[model samples]
Target: MSAPMPTGVHYHQRSRELALTYDINGESQSFRLGAEMLRVYSPSAEVRGHSPEQAVLQTGMKYVGLKNITPVGNYALKLHFDDGHDSGLYTYAYLWEMIENRELWWDDYLHELKKANASREPLGIPLQRQ
Candidate 1:
């Protein structure tokens, strides 16, 4: 089954989040999705690969930012990240899945990072962008 279509999809540059709003049962629900989450969990073949075993683990994406978002027909949106990743076509259902399972997925991602001795920080430093 398809997820409820979003009424609004707006990116907040200052906060680095994609604000998705939907109307369900006459109630308004909004989700603030971080750019880093989108990048690390990208649906592109480069990231997800063709099989589960071939999936690539993304690290150092804590500070990733969205460069652009383009609507793909009416079913999906193409997200372009600042790191030159723009292949993922985020479908409405998939985006909803992210919203519903963020905590679980995040915990799993952190576990994977830890197992690999990976850090979200690049060069172990937090670089401020002006």
Candidate 2:
């Protein structure tokens, strides 16, 4: 109903997923956003670009994981992805936007991948961490 107030955020390394809990309209809601979704939908200039026409489609990022997360002065988070992608600044507003648009964006991504004859799998297998 309104902007969600983030109560907690956690990145699970083993599953490469982010758990977000927020309070909206006095109701607490939780969501688990996957690493592949985050990486592919990064808001960095490299991914989103200066203009819509200049955007780049990310591919072969199925194995990317959340390595670290740093709070950015209360306004945003600096996400360090396992695949050396750490430039995107994910703001609370943007994260909410991601939640809202997840389905449409994912479908578009899948369609793009199919049209490009590309795969979500990585070129090489990822090594398991002990």
Candidate 3:
């Protein structure tokens, strides 16, 4: 079966959410994706790496937000992050997978963080003692 095509895409600035609308199997569906979630799960080579063992852990993205989104052909989107990351090509299938498995994926991410003793909080600038 072919993937559902997105009928509309809207970014809510104040809420830092992306709304994707699609029609599938004669039903209309809308997905609200959070900016932080998208940033952490970016499909860029820098983030995902070439192998599962080489996947980079995304830290300090608790408050990350999207800056822009550009379409790459008819198959995917190039997301521009506020932190200057813009290499991930988010395909329709990937977006659907994320929507469907968000809970499982989030759990795994949290587990990895716990195992690594990592914090999602952004890094703070160190103060200079005079």
- Give the Cα-based TM-score of candidate 1 against the true structure: 0.93
Q: Give the per-residue Cα lDDT of candidate 1 at 25.
A: 89
lDDT of 1 by residue, 1-130 (tens): 4598899999998889999999988999899899988988999999999999999989998888888999999899999998899999999999999999999998999999999999777666676754
Give the alpha carbon lDDT tens digit for every residue of 7-109 in model 2: 9998887788898898777888888888999998999999989999888888898878887899998778889988899999999888888888888988999
Off by over 4 Å in 3: 125-130
* Candidate 3: C-alpha lDDT: 0.85
Candidate 1 local Cα displacement, residue 7, angstroms? 0.4
Best candidate per lDDT, number? Answer: 1
**Clashes in candidate 3: how many?**
0
After the best TM-score superposition of candidate 2, give how far the Cα of residue 2 lies from its true spot, in angstroms. Answer: 3.9
lDDT-wise, the better of 1 and 3 is 1
Model 2 segments beyond 4 Å from truth?
Answer: none
Better of 1 and 3 by TM-score: 1
Q: What is the lDDT of residue 38 in candidate 3?
A: 88
Alpha carbon lDDT at 93, candidate 3: 84
